[model samples]
Target: MAYHSFLVEPISCHAWNKDRTQIAICPNNH
Candidate 1:
């Protein structure tokens, strides 16, 4: 099996695509 990880800033909100192959996030800085 394989896995993945990400490093990001504090997020206020997030969403995923229908297929879940992509993602979107809104940082709290704004």
Candidate 2:
């Protein structure tokens, strides 16, 4: 799940975010 953050940032494109349910569970979402 934490691995997904890598894609979340670049792909965000305008302060957007993908489902953070997984990110919230991640140990490195900080």
Candidate 3:
């Protein structure tokens, strides 16, 4: 599978919206 990087920070977790049209991510910077 091919993945894309939209965030510059390392992501700890991610979630997609109900329609899967948007995303929410938690970065490991904190």
Candidate 4:
């Protein structure tokens, strides 16, 4: 799995499935 950061604030949280083919994410602000 991998992640990215923004210039202002944290954007979101994410995760990947066992095979690395699927992914899920949650917006940090919401």
Candidate 5:
């Protein structure tokens, strides 16, 4: 597993086709 440093206020994914965006987040201590 890899930990990435994301500095954005919130990481968001946008879909142009009206589909839902996908994201993975750590749940326990994230």
Candidate 6:
């Protein structure tokens, strides 16, 4: 899956918006 790296932070879990234009990421706190 080709994605824009600068847009999304390095995360283990994420969900794209309904339109697939934006994303919600769960940042790791470690």
lDDT of each: 0.49, 0.43, 0.56, 0.50, 0.36, 0.62
Question: Candidate 3 deviates by what RMSD?
Answer: 5.5
lDDT of 4 at 2: 40
User: How far is each candidate from the true structure, as Cα RMSD in Å?
Assistant: 5.4, 9.8, 5.5, 5.6, 10.2, 5.4
Clash count for candidate 5 is: 0
Per-residue CA lDDT of model 5 for 1-30, tens digit only, reads 222443342444321234423345545325
How does each model score on TM-score?
0.41, 0.22, 0.44, 0.40, 0.20, 0.45
Residue range 1-30, candidate 4, lDDT tens digits: 243433233434545579856656565544
TM-score, candidate 1, is 0.41
lDDT of 3 by residue, 1-30 (tens): 113564544445766679867767665532
Better of 1 and 2 by lDDT: 1
Q: Which residue runs does candidate 5 get wrong by more than 4 Å?
A: 1-20
Better of 4 and 6 by TM-score: 6
Question: C-alpha displacement of 11 in model 3, angstroms?
Answer: 8.5
Clashes of each: 0, 0, 0, 0, 0, 0
Question: Which parts of model 2 are misplaced by more than 4 Å?
Answer: 11-30
Top TM-score hit:
6
Query: What local lDDT score does residue 18 receive in model 5, on the 0 to 100 scale?
Result: 40
What TM-score would you give candidate 2 relative to the actual structure? Answer: 0.22
Residue range 1-30, candidate 6, lDDT tens digits: 458673455555667779987767665622
